[model samples]
Target: MFPYFCLLIVTSFCAITEPFYKKQKSIKCILLSCFIVLVLFSGLRYDVGMDYLSYKTWFLSGRGFSEQGFILLTRIFRSLGPTIGFNFFVFIIAAVTLYGAYRFIYKYSSAPLLSLFIFFCFGQYFISTLNLIRQELVIYVFLGCLLPLIIERHFIKYTLCIATCSYFFHYTALILIGIYFLDRHFSAIIKLSGIALITISSPIIIYLIENSDYAVYLKLDIFVAKVTVLQYYLLALSVIIALLYFKCFQGKPMTKKDILFENINYINILFGIMIIMFSNTPIIQVISRLSYYTMPIYIILIPNFISRLSLRSNRLIFRYAFILLYTLIFLVAITTNGKLQHYVPYHSIIF
Candidate 1:
C-alpha cells in the first residue's frame, strides 16, 4: 500500500510539473525509465488481486480459447519467474499503450504533456495496474495503437479490425464499436444534449433494469457495485469538462478533430452515467465496462483544451488542480474497501 501510494504521488507530481519539459527527450526518457522500474518492482509483490490469480491459473493450466493469446504470450515469460515474468509482460503492454497514447495526442493535438497527464490522472489506469486486469489492459493498449489511424483517416475498416481485436481481448471492447460510429457522425451539440438526457434519465433506466425481465439473463449486481463510485467521479468530471468546453468556445472555433473529440467525450460521459445508474440491470450493467474505451479520449481532449490556454498561471493552476484532484481520487480508490495490500515492493532490482 505504501509503495502504491508513493508511485501515485510521484507520478501525479511529475505529471503536473513536467509539462514544461515535455519537448525534452531526456525528460521523457527519465520519466519512462522510472515508470519501467516501478513496473518491475511491482512484480515482487504477492499476487494481491483475484484477477491476477485467475489469469495465472488459466495460463498455467493451458485453458480454453478464452485468454489463449495472453496465455501464449505469458508462457514464454513463465520460464523466468512466473509472477515476475508475467508482471514484466503486463508492464510492457501498459508501457506500449502509454507510448501509443502519447503519440496519438502528439499527432492530433499541440499539447502532448497535458494529454499524458489526463491519461495518468484517470483512476482506471492506476487501479487497473494494482488489479492487473490483463485482458482489459491489453485492449486499452490496442486501442491506443489504433488511435492515430482512427483520428487521421477515419477509416472504418481499419477501425473495425482494431475494435475486433480489442473485443477479442475483452468482450467489453465491443461497446467501443458504437463509439467509433459516434465519433464519425455525431455533432457536439447533439452529443452533449444526448448525454445530458442520459444523465437526467439515469434513475429511470436503473429502475427499469431493476424491475425488468432481462435481469434474469444479466447479473448486474457486480457491475452496479463497481460503478457507483466511478459514476460520481465521471459525472463531476463531465460537468467540469463541459464547462471548459463552453468557456473555451468563444476563443477558437471548434475544428473537425475538436468536434470529433468532444463528441467522443460526450459519448463516454453518457456511457459512464448509464453504467453507474443502471449497474443493477443486466445489459446496461455490462455496458458500464465500455467506460475504459472512452477513458483515453478525455485525456486526449482535456489536455488539448488546457494547452490552448493563453496564460501561464492558468496552465499551472489547472495542471496542479487536475493533478491534485486525480491524486486524491487515486488514493481514495486503492484505500477503499481494504483493497490496499502490503506486498513486497515491485522494484526491478532483485533482492
Candidate 2:
C-alpha cells in the first residue's frame, strides 16, 4: 500500500510538473505507461477475489453460460495453470480498462493533468484491490469507451449498443442505461428530492423486503444478505458529498460534457445509497453494482475541479480537502475488508 501511495505521489507530481517541461509528451508517455504496467502487475499475482469463485464454478458446471462467459475464458486459461490463466485475464482486462480511462479523460477534459490526478485520486489506483473479475472490469472498459461516444451525440442507439455490450459481462450494466437518461434529464433538485424520499422510505422498504411477497421474486435465498449500519452510513455520506458537489459546481462555467461527468458521479452516489438502503434485496444488490460503471467519472471530474484552483492558497486548501475526503473513504473501504496489497509494487512491465 505504501508503494502504491508512492507511485500515486510520483504520478501526481509528474502530472503537475510535466506540463511545464519541454519534453512534455515523452514524460506523459512514460508516466502513463508506468501507470498501466503497475495496474497489470498488481492484478497478476493477486488472488482473484473470492467473488469470482462462484463464476468459476458456474463456468465449470456449464451453468449460467451467458453470465459466465468471461469466467469460461479464464477457466480455459486455468487449464493451462490457475495462476497463469488468472494473471493473464487480469493483465488483459486491466490494460483495457487503463486505456479506456485514458481515452475517456482525454476526450472529456482539456486538462490532462487534471484527468490523471482524478484517475489516481478516485478508485483508479485501487483497481487491483478487488479480486480480478473479468466481467466487472470489462464492463468498465467498455463503458469508458462508450461514454465518449455517448457524450458526443447523446444518441439512444449508441447508448443501447454500449449498454448491451456491457450487459454481456454483467446484467447490472443495464442500469447504466437508466443513468444515462437521468444524467440528461434530471435536475439537481429532483435528484435531492428523490434521495430524500428514498431515505425516508428506507425503513418501509427494508420491512417489505424482510416480510413480503416481493422477497420471493427478489430471490432472497441464501445468496442475499443484509449490509451493516456502517456501510449504510458511509453510503449516505457519499450521497451527501455528491449533492454538495453538484450544488458547488452548478451554474459554473462547466461545459455540458463536464456537467454530464459530474452527473454520473452523482448517479453513483445515489446508486450506492440505494444499494445500502436495500442491501437485503438481491435484485437491488445486483443492480447497485452498476455504480461501478461510473467510477471513472469521479477520477475525471474531481481532479479537473482541483486543477482549476489558481492561487497557491486556494490550491493548498483544495488539496488538503481532497486528501481528507479520499483518506476518509479509503479508511472506510479498508475497514470493510478492502485490502490494497494487490495494487502495491505493481510488477507487470511491458518494457
Candidate 3:
C-alpha cells in the first residue's frame, strides 16, 4: 500500500505541476517515469488478482475460437508457459492503457492530469486492470484508436484497428463498431424513450428470471442476479455531471469538436444506462463487455466538465463532489463486494 501510494503521489504531483503545451520533453519524461512504475507494478505481480490462476490456465491452454486475438497471445505464450505469458500480457496491457489514456487526455481534455486522477479514482487505471485483464486491453486498444477513427477521420486505419480488435473481443468490437458508425446526436424524445424502456423493462426481466420454467434452457439461470445498485448510482452521477456541463453551455458558443464530443458522450451514457437496466438479463456478459467500452467517455467527460467550465462555482462544486463520490465508491467496494476480497492485503510477485 505504501509503495503503491508513492507511485500515485508522484503521479499526482507530476499531473498537478505539468505546464501547458510547451515542453514536450518534460511531459514525456514524467509520463515515461509513471509508465515504468505502472508496468513494473502490474507486470511483475504473481497471483495478485482474483482471476490470476484462471488467466494462467487460459494462457496455457490457449483454446478458443472466439477472441482469436487473446487466443493468439496464449498460443505465443504456450511455448514459454503460463507464468511468462501472463507477465508479458500484463506488461503489454499496462503499457498500452497508460499510453492510450495519456494520449487521450492530452488531445481532448481541458485538464489532463485531473483526467488521469479521475481515471485512477474511477477504477479504470488500477483496480479494473488488475481483474478484468482481457477487457482492459481491448478497451484501451480501442481508445488508442479512437482519435484516428473519429476525431481525425482516418477511416481506413480506424476500420483496420476495429477489425483487429473485433478479432480479439467480438462483443466489444461489435459494440464499438456500432458506436463508431452511429456517433450522432439523438433527439431528446429518443433519449428519454430509451431511459423509459430501461425503467419499464426491469420488472419484466426480473419476472422472466424468476418464473420461466425454461430459464436454464434460455441461460436466464446464469443471469438470475439483480441489477447492481452501485452501477445505477454511477449512471445517475454521470448523468448529473453531463447535465451540469450541458446546462453551463446553454446559449454559449460551442466548437464543432465540442458538439461532436457532447453528442458521442450522450450516446455512451445511454449505452451504459441501457446495460445497467438489462444487468440481470441472459446477455449479462455481453452487457458487461459493452460497459467497459463506454469508459473513454467517462474519462474525457468528467474532467472536461469540471476543468473546462468558465464558471468557477461549477468547477468547485463538480470537483469536490467528484472527490466525495470517489470516496463513497471506495467504501462501497470494500464493504459490498466479496470478489474484491482478493484485492485486500495487496501483494505482488516482486516487492
Q: CA lDDT, every prediction?
A: 0.59, 0.57, 0.64
State which candidate, 1 or 2, has the greater TM-score.
Answer: 1
The predicted structure with the larger lDDT, 1 or 3, is 3
For candidate 2, write residues 1-351 as lDDT tens digits.
555566556656655554455664775685567557556544553443454445445544546556554445656766766545555655666666667666665655545554565455544234433453545455555555766555666567766765655544665556556555533646658878977887788778767776976667556466575775544544664565565566677766655565566576666666666776766567565544555566555555555555666785785566556555665554455444444333333333243
TM-score of 3: 0.80
Prediction 3 global C-alpha lDDT: 0.64
TM-scores of the models, in the given order? 0.76, 0.70, 0.80
All candidates in order of lDDT, best leading: 3, 1, 2
Range of the 10 consecutive residues with the lowest summed lDDT in candidate 2: 340-349
- lDDT per residue for candidate 3 within 1-351, as digits (tens), equals 555456556655655564354676666666656666776777777676787777777777776346867688667766675666677776776677666666766677665655665666555445677777766766766665465566556667777777777776454565666555544455568867877877788668757766777566345465544556656665675687668656876777766556556665666566566666656566555565566766556666777766766787787677666656655665466445524546555567665
TM-score of 2: 0.70
CA error at residue 296 for candidate 3, angstroms: 3.7
Tens digits of per-residue lDDT for model 1 on 96-178? 54554545555664455444545554556534554545544554554556554556665776567665565445555555555
Tally clashes: model 1: 3
lDDT of 3 at 45: 70
